[model samples]
Target: MVLYAPLLFLLVLVGVQFALWALAQLGVQYAANHALQTTRVSGGTAAAGRADAAAVLDQVAGQVVVDPRVSVTRNPDTATVAVAGRVPAVVPFLRLQVTTEVSAPTERFRALTLSLTSPSPAGEGDPR
Candidate 1:
């Protein structure tokens, strides 16, 4: 029984470490998904799309316990949006960074230039 105690403790410790790593990955995925959603709603406009993506990233950063650093890039011509973010590990005495990227299709419109429309008030309703 005495010999088994140390082994059990070690297994528990390793399991906790793995859980932290999984959490970090989940955080990265969350940030990526948020950014992609923002880009889709913002449309193909350069400035507005970037701003929307940034806002989404900010929201995720606020909720995540890890370091918050997000980058958003949009190609209006190609109608593609890319979002990237890094999540820090939660375990003590360990330094791990998990980066994730997500790409989304841009909005479709007949006109080359997107029309400037006022954004609806936050939490009012669905933007779509």
Candidate 2:
């Protein structure tokens, strides 16, 4: 009976540790997605994305992660946001890392062009 009690206590501790890790994962993902959404908007720049990611990490995952990193990339048609960091783990010997990326299209409209040309005598004479 004493042995069973110890084992049950260990199991409960493991469960609690796992739950904390899961919550940290969710926090990182939410931060990454929010940063991406902000950067993908029209006139938004990569600098803005990085700033937003940092802010979110501080607000959400600061306690769980150490040495957080944020990266932002831009293309003609799309923008990308990446967030990465290390999270505290249950075991002291093991180090945990988390990374997430999100991308979205820029919210802008392409300008339409219209062209008009006068009829030429060469076109009227050529039936072929």
Top lDDT model: 2
Among all windows of 10 consecutive residues in model 1, the one with the lowest summed lDDT is: 77-86
- List candidate 1 segments past 4 Å from native: 42-64, 77-93, 111-128
Clashes of each: 0, 0
lDDT of each: 0.58, 0.82
Model 1, residue pairs in steric clash? none
After best superposition, candidate 2 residue 2: deviation in angstroms? Answer: 3.9
What's the TM-score of each model vs. the native? 0.55, 0.76
The alpha-carbon lDDT assigned to residue 124 of candidate 2 equals 84
Provide the RMSD of all predictions against the true structure, rounded to 1 decimal: 12.2, 6.6
TM-score of 2: 0.76
lDDT of 1 by residue, 15-66 (tens): 7767755665665566566556655654445455456645655654443435
**lDDT score for residue 88 of model 2:** 76
Task: Let me know the TM-score candidate 1 reaches against the reference structure.
Answer: 0.55
